[model samples]
Target: MDEQRPAHILVVDDDREIRELVGDYLERNGFRVSHAGDGRQMNAVLATRAPVDLIVLDLMLPGEDGLSIFRRLRAESRSPVPVLMLTARSDDVDRIIGLELGADDYLAKPFVPRELVARIRAVLRRVRMLPPSALAESAVRTIRFGDWRLDLLQRNLIDRGGVVTPLGGAEYGLLRLFLDHPQHIFSRDQLLAQLARREFEIEDRSIDLRVSRLRRRLGDHARDPRYIRTVRNEGYVFAQPVSYEA
Candidate 1:
């Protein structure tokens, strides 16, 4: 029997020393690592090389910044390759923006290499264990709530008028969980445990941010949310009735 191949990761950063350090560390941990200096190089490598399981993208790049690259990747790529963002310690705005833009996770600069590895593993595990509906090839499974339709196979949100809205990995995961368990109130800790597979210091605010983004995509007002409603002193609940079709 052929041995299973190690997961391949692409590290995209303009910082040469940091890239090499991360690449070597990941390689030492039994992952196949590739390096790219900038967005251009990153795109080139992705186009010609074998499929990458995850991407470690730095927020700061020489020419095209990481956010722009991430947006373009989400818009263009058919594959939902998970992305882990690297940002400076002070880049709070960038970090939130990265999450809103669909990054699976992120680490601030000056982080432990081991932590990065753990995050990578967690993301891969979550992706691998996605719902069977998401993995089905012959048929598309979708959950309809309100006027929105979530295509599990395509990982996109469509409206009554058939407008497609792309969702980030975290956003999609959270939304999927909510749709699967509509009208159920999920506490912050429960949500973190359910959605984020890896052990990380995820703040309650992070979950709030993701929910906020999802609400925006669903066009649900926070104050008078028709879909997701916040329970006082508790957690959020998906108030709308949900129906699934395969």
Candidate 2:
């Protein structure tokens, strides 16, 4: 992400070996790296000259663990840095808690360093993943689709009530696909294909769950929906006209 800026990333782990290993690997990947043995050390690193784009944090620590640090970060910091939680447990609860608490991603301990690098790159890439022509879009300004006023460049979505709702990863992707191809009936498989190109994914159920989640974000009730309509035996349809100003 920010290839020219050389992403500044801080590694926080009680394990000295882990801290250096991760820091060195990230530095070798052409990123600026900082290491901290604990949460206090992490705080010191955050006060450095160069800003940190992301953090690789271990779940267990000598005193302040990754989850604790994450809570403190949300409570205290003005700017929230994306976090990749490192854990030794394969517990689903750990993963769920980390995600629920705003972690961008997670890595189990004893993972491939190469995969680690890839995950880091992927997470950072999202922050800088705007299309090459995004600047032009921002310059021209507004995009409206049916009753939804989507600020394409700003990544802002305003509904019919003028309420600004925050959308997560998969929700935005699905919404974008539906908006881009209004009136087209796409099977779940087709939707999955489109999303797979953008992000790492799993089963068709993941797509359904994302759609359900998106509906919640859009404040759409299944009984009486305004935007997305479901076909009982067929696939999903974007049932509305999407218009763009920019």
Candidate 3:
């Protein structure tokens, strides 16, 4: 262990058995585990100095569901840590919903500890692999595309009239990739690799959905698109040239 791998995983679940077991398992596997019983506990723990690197959030919490907590954190307009949803629901629709809600990974109940550890490692690796240029800097840069202005430092989307739009974790990553490499047609696989930094999770169509959300925020008409253009056979392209002010 490097003793400074730079990761703080927050595990939230209502079941004490699951929480303790999962926390212990993750700890033994070289993770700094912080456990919470509910959304309130999660918030309280997050209020302390140690910034959470990722979240292992259960869906059916006692008072506030995982979605609500995720939303509350997202509403603060900051880039949320990547979430790994732990759910009992095995439905495809449920999985899709979680993915849409910005969960970086999903693990159904009765999952092996190894699988969970693997997912955690993948997400943590993504965190570590972020280029130093993206978020850490003195002066933040702004990139304008149609009706949207992306503030890299603040991790926000401002409309043409200057109303700020909050970005989900995965959405923020995808936008960062596009802004970093504009006009290049990247296939879904390439986009996922670039965005997740090799943290493999979710179906490939999730890329389409994330891009769709960005397009909606930009008010870019799908029928007559201006920003991200979809290629029939190849992939998608960020149609606008990006400018960054350091």
What are the per-residue Cα lDDT tens digits for candidate 2 across 111-168?
8888888878766754454334432434535557666787665667897889886655
Give per-residue CA lDDT, model 1, range 94-136, as digits (tens).
8767765667777889999999998888667656544445444
| Ranking of models by lDDT | 1, 3, 2
Most lDDT-accurate candidate = 1
Name the runs in model 1 displaced over 4 angstroms.
Answer: 1-3, 131-246
lDDT of 3 by residue, 143-230 (tens): 6656678887678999878899878777777776666545555667667655555253436777888888877877789897788889
TM-score of each: 0.58, 0.56, 0.54
TM-score quality measure for candidate 2: 0.56
Which portions of model 3 miss their true places by more than 4 Å?
1-6, 132-246
- Colliding pairs, model 3: none
Q: Candidate 3: TM-score?
A: 0.54
Cα lDDT, model 1, residue 39: 91
Number of the top-ranking candidate, with TM-score as the measure: 1
lDDT of 1: 0.80
